[model samples]
Target: MSPLPGIVGALLVLGGCMVGLRLLQRRYHPHPELVRKLMHLCVGATALSFPLLFHDPQPVWWICGVAIAFMLALKYVSPLRALLGGVLDSVDRFSLGDVYFLAGVAVLFTVSGGGLTFTIPMLVLTFADALAALIGVGYGRLRYPAADGVKSLEGSVAFLTVAFVSAHVPLLLSGATGRAESLVIALLIGILVMLLEAISWQGLDNLFIPLGTFVVLNGHLDRPLELLLFHLAAAVTLTALVLLLRRRLGLEGSALLGAAFVAYLCLTLGGWPWLFAPAALLAGYALLAHRSRLPGDIHALVALTSPGLFWLLLAVYGRRPELYYPFTLSFAAQLACAAALALPADPDGRVRPGPLAARVGLAWALVFVPYAVLLGAGGLVPALHGLCVTAVAALLCLALRRARRLSFELQTTLAATASLFGLAPLGA
Candidate 1:
């Protein structure tokens, strides 16, 4: 068989398999909405795979245009009304598949060179997105809402696992890297993609998953140490801002501020080192504040800002050696001050302790100390860093159980944060 025939055969097989899957879904599930989603996936996968087989962009464009026209016509026609209803409902129902498909296409187009550089990322997105949804929907008990309140833990795990496995397949098949190296790359990509998915709202994963995969595959970290320091700075700064704002603005506003800060940091400094900090803090605070309604909103502030304290310390001392000693002493002093403020002793007292406050403080401390230590150790033993984070997060969840009321906000936050830690090592 000629090379051309082989390529065509592969495409045919893939297309056939997808179509078969759609038929099965239609027959077994009989859910019009799900069937419509599968159809969209079919159309997209067909268009994308067309380019690879023909090696001509025109055929792919033509196919997409035709498909789009067909969809548009179906939108108006009465005979196709049943299909349209399904399509409309499916579109309304949020899933990450479209985003993954788009990302795969982007990676295919942007990476110039053939081979696995482009293909691996696309495969990762496809596999991860599909698997995450499958797992989350089928077996996921722990659900957390994304900014859009639509995402869940089951979906995230499916995404992470699929992405990892997808990336691993290409690495193994290409024979370009060792098992250990392939494992590391898979872990890194999986963790990074999962992080992006967790924080995304309202189908924004469409933008993030592709961008994140591109960044990781590109290996854009020229100065690992400096970039890491910048991430720490941004994380800390955002954490502080979230803490300060949660009381004044409330949950949505606090989250918005934190997100804006992260965007600014990524734009100026590059990467999202601070992504988890604000997410954890604001969510946790919102949970506690809603349940307890403690006065002065100090508990909310503490919960929101606690994650930052660790990032600040790591940035000043761990990331930047020049500022280490002075910053270390200053951080020690600050902790003492915070402790003193929370204590029952000041005569012209401003700070007052609440039941939730102490637990939040402890939880914050537990997460922070291990994160800092793991991050510090990451420079030498990357795997160990991942392990430390996982361990600490598990312990944090156990610790949170002691608190009287786990607000939806805090429960979601803790679950998401724990998910972050749980995912980190898999990608690493």
Candidate 2:
């Protein structure tokens, strides 16, 4: 019952599994992916026993820490790599999945104290993720681009189905949530995490799926049926709209789905006002930029929206109203920068300042005017101040582009800077 025994036993089990996997690989010569999935299931299932074995989280943390350290050593240490290569290292893809798996276990245990929240995510990560991989490889025919590679739609659907069942059956059996609410919550989690996994690059899904499921499941545990239904509707509608207009929006595959999920969070977390800025920016970009000029990848979308996302979280969860202005300003700045860069250039491959200024002005107005109108007379000062700062940021970004050829990094930096300066008028 004590943590010390559980910790020792868990460590031993981990060690045994590794050695057994190595021996099995040597004798049977199973596929590398099959070996990796075996490791995933064995380790994750062992971790599931933590709540039963130890009363405190410290022991679980110790096991996870030790496992992570040993796995790291196994990857790099020549003798260990040679010994374990057929197990984890033989897979051809670049993945930090093994490390992320251990880290997710530690994080989930700490956050949920090894309750249903922890159990559900672990279940999804272990069973659903592994099944999806096997099914995708075996049955996948419809493929689309993910982060750096392609994934099958069949695999995504399998993940969604398994995740929904994994989340629903537990809540339904526990009787903590009503059947209908459980269904909604599970469906929502399935959809969101499926999208996350689809877009993830380099095994980041190992980390994102569990945490993202935790956030969704934890947030919706006791909500009313109507609210849960609304969330479900919102998610479905957003996904549909993104898919319908994917080409026009300059988004496809993982990028399209990622954008939809991101927008859904903004709407759900901070309501319509928060959603307005991104909506306007998206619409403005779709209208103004040529199809060739629009961003169609997750990396570019993150660069564009992360600044506003940062401010949105601060405003909503941190209960900082002033941060709302910064959130809107962040989007405005990004829109301005996007507009400036997207305009047509002269024969010399240079954009005239007049057209660039006009484009930026149009984008700024498209995004900010509605915001100003919504804020009424009192918000006029902050809106105008944000406008000025956004212009300066756009101009500065252009100068950098002219000098060094503009990069997503500069665009992100300017967006964040403009949002920070958006605080000045609030102070005044």
Candidate 3:
């Protein structure tokens, strides 16, 4: 009665087909090397599926743990040769989709309480990746690469189609009907997943794809009008800021100012707790703007900002369903500001500080400060604390410009001290 048996059986059948194909390629087709490689891939996939079939504790653990150990061993040993024959490249050379597949299975086991709706979207990534590769290699012609010339439009379309269809499977199984709704949801999810894959360079989409699918599927988007307006306003403001900065100030100054503006907006919006990201943006500008430095300072700023800010925004507004739109708007505004400041501009532009600073300050005012006021008056003292915290952060940043090697201990102390004052006694 358990779906686990059926799932495992499906995986095994797929793997067996792959193995059979490899055998045919080796015996009749005479492509021994390709056959060996395919065989290894099939073996790995089949071994991974074993846990899905037998849902006992030991078998599941052995399937996962042993499979991982086997992969690791293959990285050192010639796994392809061991499985079939002939030396093959390291497993690292292959996309780590197997890991994602395993992770999805783990997620399914852990969150089975949420029903099939929860586990269904994850399959989209697996199906999409394989389907895209298959289609692209066979029929790809139209290419579209963001930076490197490795991506193609054919691949994108294939990925989107497969992911979209795969995303609908669980929904259909769970009783979602009406051909129109299913098609629309599938299309939306597919597009989003493809987009994430296209932009992701560091293979982060393995995690982001499934997670994003889950959010979009479960989360409500009731304020489309507000979201659209907020995005438009943010985009316009960012464009104006970039154009003004480029015309009035040199690229370097604009970069610094733009980074600062974005940082301020993020802090004000309550997304990030510190100003370090903005500072890093500034430092990046400093390096690119100056010919003398390697921009080691950017790392320092990133290190300071990442931890404190990473969870701040999500913690503050993630649960407040009503405030989601406003928070999304503020977050979008910050990103827009950052992108605007990062645009490439002509070198002949003059550097003017006055207008640029004012624009940055204006953005902070329109987006973050007003939101803070709304949150503060609503008895959210943390908003007030956030402002005080950011002010101290600003001062610390000014200090860091003079001394980059400020110790981690000192930084922690400073952050703690600022936090204490920021959260000063309510009456005080």
Per-model TM-score versus the true fold:
0.48, 0.95, 0.53
The sequence of per-residue lDDT tens digits that candidate 1 reaches over residues 1-428 is: 23456345544554465457545755686545345445444544444454456554434334434443444454557666454434433445555444344444544554434446656655655446545655665577876534545456667667878887877777778876666666666665675667666665555565566567666655522335454344445444654565466553344422433344443333333223333334433343344334332223223433434344434444544664322222222222222222222234234433344632454354344334434553575423433343344334433433444344434246335433433343233352
Residue range with the least summed lDDT across 10 consecutive positions in model 3: 289-298
- Please give the TM-score that candidate 1 achieves against the real structure: 0.48
Please report how far candidate 1 places residue 174 from its true position, in Å: 2.3
Q: Look at candidate 2 and tell me the lDDT of residue 138.
A: 81
Judged by TM-score, which candidate is best?
Answer: 2
Clash totals in order: 9, 0, 5
TM-score of model number 2: 0.95
**Residue pairs in candidate 1 whose N, alpha carbon or C atoms collide under 3 angstroms:** 128-159, 128-163, 131-158, 132-158, 132-159, 136-154, 187-427, 187-428, 188-427
Q: Please list the residue runs of candidate 1 whose C-alpha ends up more than 4 Å from where it truly belongs after superposition.
A: 1-27, 31-52, 56-58, 72-78, 84-88, 91-107, 110-114, 175-180, 220-428
- Candidate 3 structure lDDT: 0.45
Which residue pairs in model 3 clash with each other?
Answer: 249-350, 249-351, 249-352, 250-350, 250-351
When 2 and 3 are scored with TM-score, the better candidate is: 2
| lDDT comparing candidate 1 with the true structure | 0.46
Best by lDDT: 2
